[model samples]
Target: MHSVDHRFVELLPTPLERGVLYISGAHDIVAHLCLCGCGNEVVTPLGPAGWVLRYDGRVSLSPSIGNGALPCKSHYVIQGSRVHWLSKMTEDQHHRAQARDRDAVRGLNPTRLGRAKRLFTSLLRRGRV
Candidate 1:
């Protein structure tokens, strides 16, 4: 992966330039080009329902970025402007991860399914449910 200077800009360029993490605090958005040199744009919108960015002088994203969408599928994490590459996920793992992300994005209670299953069983008390 190409190294970036770890600079965060307020406004993203018209045509995204490489090696920069453009951050817009007003928009609560962070964007950059694919570190794998795929040239695909990666956009992380910050919100309680979306992503939460931690910037202690430098920026660090909560969840790792995975480009599961087509062509060059790359995965990596940017911690304080440093990129850490991740191994490719197996098909099953990728599918599971995608499902989890979909649930999270949809604001569905992940525990609800399991909790509902136990709710009908005698093991779960009325007060516990």
Candidate 2:
């Protein structure tokens, strides 16, 4: 229910400042993360509700299969991936799910915003003031 109406999803995301998301102690892999530590910064309270929030979706769940991904909705880390893909999740059952995950993430991440963050990181890495 990550994309549920904001009014209903509002309080659920705030109180849990700390949590642990096991990548499917069940059958599916789960993407997870902690609170952003800035509640006011979180648009979750006023984030798009209903179909409107289709872009900044709070989680990654393929509507078709019903596998609710954890809270890490940002860009995925391309761990051990090839130039063509980010990871080895090209399995048939996981195909749509991964696409949904990446799509939801891309929507959340606008090019401008990502470039800004990347610039900040690059500066930080260079120890530039």
On lDDT, the leading prediction is: 1
Q: Encode model 1's per-residue lDDT on 1-129: one tens digit a residue.
A: 635555567656657778777777755567778888878787766654446788787777767777776367687787886888887545666687678766665673556444433422521342211
Q: Candidate 2's residue-wise lDDT over 27-93, tens digit each?
A: 1132223232222111111111101112232332222222123233222221211111122323453
Show pairs that collide, candidate 2.
Answer: none
Model 2 TM-score (2 dp):
0.21
Error of 2 at 123 (Å): 19
Tell me the lDDT of model 2 at 33: 35
lDDT of 1 at 50: 47
RMSD of each: 12.7, 14.6
Candidate 1 has an lDDT of: 0.66
Best by TM-score: 1
